[model samples]
Target: MAEGILRPLGSSDLRLSPLGLGCWQFSKGRGLVGKFWPVLEDSVIRDIVRTSWEGGINWFDTAEAYGGGQSEEMLADALSALGEAGRGAHVATKWWPIMRTAGNIGKTIDERLRRLKGWPIDLYQVHQPYSFSSAASEMHAMAKLVQQGRIKHVGVSNFTADKMAEADKALREHGLRLVSNQVKYSLLDRRIERNGIMEAAKELGVAIIAYSPLEQGILSGKFHSNPELVKQISGPRKWSSGFKPEALNRTRPLIDRLNELADKYGASPSQVSLNWLIHAHGETVFAIPGASKPHHAQENVNAMRFTLSQEEIGELAELADRSKR
Candidate 1:
């Protein structure tokens, strides 16, 4: 572990390396307007997970909704492989909030645990706040898992500030507290800061897990000069409003500056992007950047070893602040 980089997930026993491996992309293909379809095969995913573990990514995240349970199976394979190699990695997964009824809460936990194949899941989260029917019952079920040692801690994802507080209050009734909130917080997406999500999490001592910390590779200088490549990678969603060419245009200056700084630091654009997040965001804040290639995985692991200067952090933040998207 790199000294001074590991940070505790507020109030939880779990300590995550600054850069975690986001396994969602291994199973879910990418697209510009939206994500691509037809998830990767089990063997391909297993290889991705193994590479991630070997690259010092001790923290891996997945969700039950990913590839309709295939993601969990893939995670299990990686966990088993890591255990065999004596790596003993940590895993975090999520439960879709649509299945929050009392009758299904306990069963859902059991099914997720079963798919994990006895590897202790460090964190289990509610994927979204789709519904809150029997919130008490659902929280209690999670509490029961902690008691049974099936899950180490509880968390929430894509939750609003208000919903996060409510969940925390309800879980506390059962003597459980949510340790983190996994939200999309990056230079390109600052909605959390404006919407009070950041403030609430800080006040409640919940760690913010920043997914898409590279802004879907936008911050890595890949799409800076090539609008056509951006469109090609965006797939059918290219026509979607979210995949507009204007967004790519907005990122050019930041991309150029990132490249310049990356050269100075002897790192890739991806590493600079991750380092920028760590410095501009809180020390408790951690990012999970997805990588489909082995070299990409290696670059991500190397990102944790460096520090961004205060001046560079501010310059990058200002550059992003000026970006429209």
Candidate 2:
């Protein structure tokens, strides 16, 4: 259960473990997005949370769009059942913007709280940059939530460098600061590095929460080792370009390096991938890998047990960069 030091989530007072439990997979088969995962029984949910909690993970990330609050409710139920709620267990949930405007940020605060069963929303994020309202407007609405003690801090997801600036500026106007930006970051998906998001986050002191850090299990090296395994993968990931035979061939070197390091450290390829993610960018990057089962949760925790050397980190980065080209 040993792990790395806790890092700041941004300008917020919350110090988080290197990884958090991504609760999107706990969607319980409800909403549109929830259909991606199978409905987990309450006992299974409890085991996942308990394993993660006992492994030293202090926080969790879920979304309002995830099963339309089914994830939040179930996560809350799991934590409460395990006696971890309100006991250093921070919960972060997002507001689904999509066609909605900033008004909905306030309108739905109670529903979020209602589903959480009075659990404080440690960090509330605007689900995406495509909201009907501007980033400034969304941040302003989130600031109001902070003032009312509805939420502890504000964040955004899938935002560009410029949009992150707008949200930060809006929060600073109200004497608050944008805490984090959750994005689709992984070894295979390094668009944020080439794009301006990484630079802007560092300059603005915003934390980058890397979601899908394992690249939807591609970095786990299972698909590459056993090509036939792809057929068993449910949901849209099988259709993703990364799961294709050629893409697997393309990323073979990076996965090979990950596997080598996994063997060297006595860990799994997914753990090596997750370790590199949280360490490669210093404290600026944190990851939230999903866990459908207790063993997956334990693997996520083990990822924290070892630190990839700087040389190994650079080696993997170079391999990833080459694979992309």
Best by lDDT: 2
Residue-by-residue lDDT tens digits, candidate 2, 66-123? 9999999999988887663437788999999989999999999999999998688999
- Pairs clashing in candidate 2? none
The per-residue C-alpha lDDT of model 2 at residue 189 equals 89
TM-score for each of the candidates: 0.89, 0.98
Look at candidate 2 and tell me the lDDT of residue 284.
94
- Model 2, which residues run further than 4 Å from truth? 1-4, 84-86
Clashes of each: 1, 0
- Could you report the Cα RMSD, in angstroms, for every candidate shown? 3.1, 1.3
The lDDT per prediction is 0.75, 0.91
Best by TM-score: 2
